[model samples]
Target: MHADILLRGGDIVDGTGAPRRRGDVAITDDRITATGDLSDWTAGRDIDCTGRIVAPGFIDPHVHHDEIVLTDPGMDCMLSQGVTTIINGNCGFSIAPLTATGPLPQPLGMILSNDAPRFATYAAYRDRLRADPPAVNTACLIGHGTLRINEVANLDRPADRDEIAVMARALDAALSEGGIGLSTGPFYPPARASTTGELTEMARVAQAHGKLYVTHMRDEGDRVIEALDETFQIGRDACCGVHVSHHKCAGLANHGLSETTLAMIDRAMQTQDVGLDTTPWTASSTMLNSGRHRQASRVIVADSTPHPEMAGRDLADIAAGWGTDIDTAMERLLPATGIFFIMDEGDVRRILAYEHTIICSDGIARGSHPHPRVWGTFPRVLGHYVRDAGVFDLETAIRRMTSMPADRFGLRDRGRIAEGTYADAVIFDAATIREANDYAHPTRPAEGIDLVFVNGRESWRSGVHSGARAGVVL
Candidate 1:
C-alpha cells in the first residue's frame, strides 16, 4: 500500500507494556494505516529508524500550560522531549470561564502570569485553540479553583450553597464544552478553604458528564493520608474517577510515605475509580508565596515578578544577599515561583515504579527559569530512571507515559502505534536518550529525541522543531 510516510525497521514498543519487536509503521494521513513487515509499502517519505525505538509519543497528563500553548504555539520544549500530547489545567488552575477582573490573585496569577489571555467560557477557549493550534495535542480539565474564583465572592472560606450551585453550573457548562474532567487544588490558597462537600458537589457535575475528578489534594505533607482519604471519599460520593495530580510526599518529615499512599490508592481502587500521575524529579515547583518552601530542605527561586533577576538563584543565597531571612526574602520576591527540594529520591523511584502510576511533568510552562521538568521530564525517565537506574523496563516506562494516560484521560485513539490509531509517535535511540537540562540550565531541549510526530505530521526532528502545528484540541 502507498502511505504518506513510513517508519522503517525500528523496535516498536507500542505503548501497551508489550515487549519491543523490530517492525515498520506506515502512516496514511493522520492515522497509522499499517504496522509490522511493511517493507514493500511505497511511501512519499521514508524514515530510517534502524537503531532507534519507536513508541507512542509521550503524554504529559498533568501540566499548567493553559496559556503557554497559545503564547508559544511551537511548544518546542515539550516536542523535543517526545511529548506529542499534553493535558493541561492541572493543579486547579485554568484560564477560562473567567469573569473575575483585576489582578488574578496569587496562585492563579502564577499560572496565567501577567499577560496570558482569559476566556469568558470554555467554548471560547476551545475555539481559540482550534483557530491557532499548538505543536502538541491539548486536552483540558475545568478547574475548581477557577470556578470558585468566578462564583465565590470570598476566598477565605468554603463556598456557600449558592456559590457551590453557581460553580456547578459553570463546571457543567465547561464539561459540556469538552472539558475532559474537573480538577481541584485544595492545596492552593484559592481553594484551600473548600470543603470536601463542596468538592464532591462539583465532582458530581463531572461525574454526570462521565468525566474524571482530578485533584492535587488538600495536602501532600503532614496531612497527606487524611487528604487521600478525603480524595477517595469525594470520588465515592461523586461517583467519578479520581486522579491525583503529581502525587508526592512533600516534606522531609514525610519521606518514604509513597509506600503507604500507594497502598491506600490500591485499596481505594478496589471500591472506586482511582488513578494518579507523578513527575520524575524530586523537586517540586510552585508559587513561592504558597508556603511550601517551609517544608522544603532547600529552595530555589524559579521566577520572581518583583525581582525578575532572581530566577535561577538559590533562595538561601538570595536571602543572604538581601541580609535577611528566607521568609523575608521569599516575601520580597512575591508573585514568584520556587522549586522546593523536599521529596526523597526513594519515594520518587517507588512512585515512578508503581505499576499504575502514569508519568507527568506537572510542568508550569512559564517563568524565566521554569522547572527543568518542562523541557526534560520524558527524557529523564527514559535515560535516568529506565536505562540507568533500572526503575522499570523500557516497555513499562513507555506504557506509563502513553497508554496509561490516554486510557485514564479517555483519549481512545491517540496513545498507541497500531492500525487505525492516530499516528503520534516518537523515535529515539534508547542508549542516548537523556535529559539535557537541569536546574542549572533549565530550558535546554532534550538530547536524543530523533523524531516526533503529531497526527502523522513531523513536529520535531533531530533536536529541532519541524514547525508543524498539526496538533488539535483533543
Candidate 2:
C-alpha cells in the first residue's frame, strides 16, 4: 500500500499497558492508516525503528505550559521530552474564551518568575491564539478566576447574586466555545477569595456541557484531606469529573502525609469522582512571594530569582543569611524568588502507580534554574524509574504517560497507536533511555529517545529537530 510515512520494524508497545508486539506503522497525512507486519508497505520515506519501542507520543494531562512563551508556544520544552499533546490551564489556570485586551503580567511570559500569565478570558485568548499560536496540540479549560474577574469587576470581595449570574453566563459562553471544562486555583489570589458555592455555580455550568473539573485544590500539605473532601463535594454537587493537578504533600511538616493523601484520593475516587496527575520530581516550584504561601515559609524554597547569588538556594537557608525567620525571609524574597523542594520521592511514585493516575510535567521552564521536569520528565520515567529501579514495568509506565492520560482527559484522535488515530508517535531505545537533568544542573536533555514524529513527519533527531512543522496549534 502507498503510505506517506512508515515506521519500519519496531517493537510496538501501543501505550495500552498490553505486551509489546513487533510491527510497522503506516501513515497517510496525519492519521495512522494501518498497523501490522508491513514489510511490503511502500512510502515516500521510511524510519527504521529496529530495536526500538514505537508508541504513542505522551499526552501530559496537567501542565502549566499555558504560561510558556505564547509567541513560540511550540511547547518545545515538553516536546523535547517526547510530549506531543498537553492539557493546559491546569491547577485552575488556563487561557481561554473571553473578551478583553489581556491583563497584568499577560499569562504567557515572565514578568515575575512567580507571576502567572493572565489573559482577557477564554474567548478573547482563543481568538488571539487562533490568529497565531505555538506548535503542539493544546486542550484548555476556562479558569474560574477569569470568570470572577470578568463578572465581579473586582478581586478583593465575594460576588453578589447578579455578579454570580453574570459569571455563570460568561462560563456558559466559554463552554460553547469548545472549552473542555472548568479549572480553578483555590490557591491563587482572585480565586482564593471565592467560596465553595461560587465554585459550585461555575462547575454547574461546566457540568451542563458534560465538562470536567481541574483544580490546584485549597491545600497540598496539612489541609490536603480537607481539600480533597472539598474537591469531592464539588464533583458531587456539580456532577463532574474532578482532577487534582501536581499532587503532593509539600512541607517537612507535611512529611509522611503521602499515605494520607493517596488514601483520601482513593476513597474519593471509589465513592465519587477524583483523578490526579504527578510529575517525576522531588521538588515543587511556584511564585509565592506573598500572603499565605509567605506565612508558610519553611516548606517553600526559592529555586530562582532576580538576585543572582540567592537564585538557587532554599528559602530557609536563604532566610538564615538574611537574619530573618523562614516566613519573614519568604516575604523579603517572594517578589524576586520562585519556590521548590515541596515533595519527596515517596509520594511521587505511589501517585504514579495509581490506575487513575496520569503523568504530567507541570512543566514551567523559567528562571535561571527552572524545574527539571520541563526537560527530563518522560525519559527519566522510562529510563531512571522503570529501567533502572524497576519500580514499574516499561509497559505500565508508558500507559500512564500515554493512553491513560488521553482517555481520562478527553483528547480525541491521539494518544493510542490504533487505527485512524493521529500518527504523532515516538521511537526510543528502551534499554538506553536516560533522563539527564537534575536540580543542580537543570538544562541537560534526556537520552535514548532517538526520533519524534508529529502528524507523521520527523520532528527531532536526538533532541535536534529537522526543521519540521507538522505539529499544529489545537
Candidate 3:
C-alpha cells in the first residue's frame, strides 16, 4: 500500500478514552487513510514516532481567540500546546453582526479589545477567516451580547418585544452563515440586564436550527444554584443542549461548591443534555469588574488600559503606589483586565475529573500578562493532573480534551485517529509533556510536543511553527 505520509511505531491513544495500542497511522492528502500494522506501506514522507503518544490534536471547547486569529494567523500559542481546534466567540462575545464601522460596545470590546474588526454580519467574519485562515480549525458561536449591542439601543435595560424579535431574526441569519450555536455571558454588565424571556427567545432560535446553547451563567459564586436552575430552564424551554462555560464556584466563601454544582448538573443531565468546561487554573481573567474584584482574595492586573506600565503588577500594590484604596485604584484603572484568584484547587480537580466536563483554556488571548492557562491548559492537564497527581489516566484526560469536545460541538470528522477522519493529530513525549508558562511569564509555550498536523499539513514540528495556514473555518 502507498500513502502520502506515514507515522510509524507510535503508541496511539486514539482520543476515545480506551487503552493505548501500538499502531501506525497512514495519511493521504488531508485524511487519515488507515491506521494499524502498515509495515509494508510505502509513503512519500515518514515520521518515526517511537516512544510517543500520537493522538488527535487537542480541541479547546471554550476560548476567546476570535480576534487574535486575525492578527496572529499562525496561532503559535495554541499550536505549541497541541491545540489544533478551538471554539471561539465564547462568553457572549463575538466580532460579528456589526452593522457599522465603529468601536465595539463596552462589554464586547472589553475582551476583544478596542481594535477588533468590524463586520456587518457573521458571514463577513467567516469570509475573513477563509481568506486568511489560522493554523487551527475554528468553530464560532453567535454571541448573545454581540446581538444585543447591535440591536438594542440601551443595554442598561431588557430589550422590549420588538427588539427581541429583531435579535431573533439576526440570530437566524448568523446561524445560516455557518455559526454553530449560541453563547451568552449574562454575568457581564451589558448582558446582566437581559431577562430570562430575552434569552429563551434566542435559545429557541438556536434550537429551531438544531444548534446548541452555551452560557457564562449569571453567577458562579454564592447564587450558582439559582444560575444553574435558570440555565436548565432555558435548555428545557429551547429544547437545546446547554454548555456551562468555565464552570467554577468563585470566591473563598463559595469554595468546595463544585460538589453541589456538579451534582446539580448530573441530575439535570438525566433529563436534558448538559455539559461543562473548565480551565486548569485557580485564577480567572477577564475585564475587570468591581463587584467580582471585591469578592476576590487577591487580584493581579493583567492589563491596565490607562496605565500600561501596571500590566503585571498586583492590584493592591498598584493601589499603594497611587496612595489610594483598592477600590479607588480599581476604579481609576477602569476598562482594564485582571486575574481574580478566587477558586479552590480541590474544586478545579473535582470538576475536571467529571465525565461530562471538557477541558478549555477560557484564556483571554490578549493583554500583556495573560493567564498562563492560555499557553498551559492542555499540557497542564496531561502533565500535572494525569501524570503527577494521579487524578486520572492519560487516556481519560486526552478524551476530555479531544473526542469529548468534538462530539459535543458537532465537529465532523475530527477528534479521532480513524480512517477517513481529518489529519489533525499530535505526537508528543508523554514523559516530558508539561506546561512551562506561569502567571509571571504567561506567554511561554509548552515542552515535549514534537509534531502537529492540521489538514495534512505540518503546522508545527520540534517546537517550531511551520507557517502553514492550512486550517479550515468550520
Most lDDT-accurate candidate: 1
Ranking by lDDT: 1, 3, 2
What TM-score does model 1 achieve against the real structure?
0.99
TM per model? Answer: 0.99, 0.90, 0.98
- For model 1, what is the error of residue 337's alpha carbon versus the real structure, in angstroms, after optimal superposition? 0.4
What's the distance in Å from true for residue 400, model 3?
0.5
lDDT of 3 by residue, 1-474 (tens): 999999999999999999999999999999999999999999999999999999999999888888889988899889999999999888898878767446766557666766667887899999999998999999899999988888788889999999999989999999999999999989887788999889999999999898889999999998999999999999999888899999999989999999999999999999998988998889998877637787788899988778888988899999999999988998898778889999999999999888888999997777788889989999999999998998899999999989999999899989999999999999999999999988899999999899999988999998899989889998
lDDT of 2 by residue, 344-405 (tens): 67777777766677878877665566767778889988988898877789899999988887
Each model's RMSD to truth, in Å? 0.8, 3.1, 1.0
Among all candidates shown, the one with the greatest TM-score: 1
Candidate 2 achieves a global lDDT of 0.73
TM-score of 2: 0.90
Q: Which of candidates 1 and 2 reaches a greater lDDT?
A: 1
Locate the minimum summed-lDDT window of 10 residues in model 1.
110-119
Clash counts per candidate, in order, are 0, 17, 0
The list of candidate 2 runs beyond 4 A from truth reads 67-69, 97-124, 131-133, 290-309, 320-328
- Give the whole-model CA lDDT for all candidates, comma-separated: 0.92, 0.73, 0.90
The alpha-carbon root-mean-square deviation between model 1 and the true structure, to one decimal in Å, is 0.8
